[model samples]
Target chain A: MKLTILGCHSATPRINTHPTSQVLEIRNHIFLIDCGEGTQVQLRKNKVKFNRIKHIFISHLHGDHCFGLVGLISTFRLLTREADLHIYAPKGLKEVITMQMKLSDSWTNYKLIFHELTSRESELIFEDDKVEVYTIPLDHRIYTNGFLFKEKENERKLLLGNAEEAKINKAYFRKLKQGFDVINEEGELIKNDTVTKAGSAPKSYAFCSDTAYNESIVPIISNVDVLYHESTFLEKLSHLADKTKHATAKQAATIAKKANVKKLVLGHFSTRYDNITEFINEASEVFENVEVAEAGKTFEF
Target chain B: MKLTILGCHSATPRINTHPTSQVLEIRNHIFLIDCGEGTQVQLRKNKVKFNRIKHIFISHLHGDHCFGLVGLISTFRLLTREADLHIYAPKGLKEVITMQMKLSDSWTNYKLIFHELTSRESELIFEDDKVEVYTIPLDHRIYTNGFLFKEKENERKLLLGNAEEAKINKAYFRKLKQGFDVINEEGELIKNDTVTKAGSAPKSYAFCSDTAYNESIVPIISNVDVLYHESTFLEKLSHLADKTKHATAKQAATIAKKANVKKLVLGHFSTRYDNITEFINEASEVFENVEVAEAGKTFEF
Candidate 1:
């Protein structure tokens, strides 16, 4: 899995810095997260294929988080897209989007699907053979949900030399991969351990942003391979963190350390500070494996 | 009066070209017209005093025309603006804007007033001491209206020597500036024209964009000093213009000539075209005082 940072700044878009937006690629699926203004241009700069973005997820309705959505949809319509597009966002997104289209009399040729979200509890929002995604309830000023993508368990591989000589038939192979004992045509028991080996362990990624230092999320997203949490401030401004409902670098590191995530990625920095070294320095005090999330940077797991 | 083109391209924004937005300063009042994506950055690059913009007029709710509004508003809020903002747009815009603020849980500290348009007839919408703005109905695929800003008649200046010889009283000076017959303190009737000369001729500007080549706007915006019109295509693609409810460069110039406008400016060219010379060449065929609207370029009337 590869994740690309399209934009990570807080507040508003600038000539050099953009607001919150990113792209997560797992297996064959490309998911758009929190599209901000100038996102399409950022996507072009990052070399992301416009047609391949099938699903878009918005964390909240902040102008910085989802303002780019309507423009991107309009561009897709202008490009004559025919594929169905799915948007998973908080409730009221449909009304905001439809109003613009209504006044402009511009309709999309493609199927525009909106999956309005209102749940305050964790639930599966999307699932396929390769990955399963669930919403991570967040504590914020508004209704917000973070998404966690967990790779599903893979099928066991048959030990070719051992299985062929062990008289493992095609019918029994299915049971062997599932670690089940199968009786052959001769009515003899066949042990699964001798014919198949276990598959690779599934890896998961958790995305948390625009939230304060909340430890309640640790249980839901524990043991994630990679955790991307917002660090809008450093330890110096820890007092301001609570008032704004945002986390500092130290707080994010504490969450990553408590959740036992393998790697901690920090982003969504406030544009007040000119340098980013302070964030990594502060996060490294609690979490050993911490990295800064820079624009156009990619992380692989 | 000075008109500045913030952006002039159509469709998606590019690294070199912006989508659509402009700024017009009439007698020190700054007006933002059609805020497309990346407008704030454009404003910053052009060194525009964005805080001076007290009013914004949107033609329709097309994403390219209004996507930047929310972000700009948010930026103003972040900057702690305390002035009230006035927006004139079509109906449904209030819902769209308010929903974003509601979802984000962030509203402007200043008063946000909206004038929602739901009619097909032309009407006066804005007025101040020096200028008055009215809507000019246009034909389009959507409910679009062009704006006409006419400089109001100014107070006549007194000819000092003539006023003294006419025995005009200081109390009647105000009435004399209004072109009224003034009675002096000595009970002598003084013709206003004898003491005061006529003020400067009022200048006018008309903005027509994202519309078909409609002639109905001529009567509403008749005899404007300068007209800025959208020319999405050249004369070669006149058929495509008809199909898309847009005008070619020559067609825009034709409207300017028919309306007896003194000058014409063409913009909103499609990104598919490599050069903008075709629009100028086509528009210059009919209108002698024609200028191509380029980004960061300003025109004075």
Candidate 2:
């Protein structure tokens, strides 16, 4: 899986810095998350194929999070895109986007689907043969939801030489890869462990932002391969974080530590700071594997 | 009067090229016209003070014209702007903007006043003691209206030496500046022309965009100091211009010539062309004084 940080700054978009937005590639799907204003331009700058974004996930209704939705949708229509587009966002996004379309009288030629999410529980929102997506309800001033993408466990790998030496029939090869004992050509039981080995471990990623330092999400995102959490404030401004319902870098690191994520990616830095290296330095105090999410940067796992 | 081209390219916004948006500074008022996506960033890059933008004029409901409005409004709120903002746009913008604010639950603390226009005929939309703004209806895919900003004729300039030679009393100085003949202290009539010369010829700017080759606006914008018209295509693509309700460079120049404007500024060029100098060459064929509006370029009139 590959993740690209199209924008990671908070509150407002600047010349060099952008608001919150990212592209995630997993299971042959490109998912757009938190499309702030100028996201379409950022997508073009990052050389992301426009049509590959079939699914969009919005964390909240703040302008910094979802204001780019209408422009992207309009651009798609201008480009004459025919593929169906899906948006998973908090309730009321449909009303906002459709209203703009109605006012402009520019309806999309393709199917535009909206999957409004409002449940507070960690419910399964999307699933396919290779991956599953679940909602991580977050604590914020308004309705918000973070998404967790998990790759499904792969099929066990078959030891080709060992299977052939065991005189296993070709038809039983499938069963051996399924971690099940199968009958050999001599009608004798063939242990699956002797002919098969475990497959590579499944990977998972969780995205959380615009939320306060809450422990409720730790259980839901525990042991994920990578966790991207918002660090909108530094430790010096921790009080402001609490007042604004945002998390400090130290608080995000504490959450990552408690969740036991393999890697912690910090983002959503406030624009007040000229340098962002301090965010990583502060986060690393609690979480050993911590990195800052810079615009146009990509992480592969 | 000064005009700043924040973005002038046609169609969708790109990394270096932006959509339709500009700033007109007339009579100490900074008016934002046609705020396309990423306009706020452009404004910042141009070093335009955020507080000076008290009024915004949207040409139409097209995404390329007004998609950045919501984000600008939200940023104003985040910055705690206290001054009221006035928006003059085609009908239905208020509903579209208010709905987004309602959905996001991020209403602005300052008053957001909307003046929706629906009349096809030219009408005065804004006016003050120093300046007046009129809407010049244009032909387009939707209900679109271009704006005509005219600096009201200034008070006659005070010829201090001539006024003193005429023995005009201090109390009559105000009357002389108002272009009126006044009674001197000697009880003699002092001619206004002897006391004061005509003030700098009143300057006017006409913004016409996203319109077809319609001559109806020529009379409304006639004799203006500067006319900024959309030239979305060249002569070779004039057929596409007609189909898209846009104008070619030649057509824009023809309109400028017919209107008898002092200077013609061409903008809103389609992205298909890599060389913009050709547009200027094409337009110069019909009008002597023609220039292309480049992004981040400022024009003084």
Q: Interface RMSD computed for candidate 1 is what?
A: 1.2
Tell me how far the alpha carbon of residue A288 in candidate 1 is from the true structure, in angstroms, after superposition: 2.4
lDDT of 1 at B32: 92
lDDT of 1 by residue, B89-167 (tens): 9887888888788868898999999999877998999998889999988777778888999889988988888888777
Collision pairs in model 2: none
The numbered model that scores best in TM-score is: 2
Compute the lDDT for candidate 1: 0.88
Global Cα RMSD, each model: 3.5, 1.6
**Clash pairs detected, candidate 1:** none
Candidate 2 lDDT over residue span A132-236, tens digit each: 999999998889999999999877999999988889989888878778999888889988889899988889999999899999999999999999999999989
What docking grade applies to model 2? high
Off by over 4 Å in 1: A155-200, B155-199
Restricted to chain B, the TM-score per model reads: 0.96, 0.98
lDDT by residue for model 1 over A8-75, one digit each (tens)?
98888887888888999997999999999989889989999889999998888878888899999999
Complex DockQ per candidate = 0.62, 0.83
Candidates' TM-scores?
Answer: 0.90, 0.97
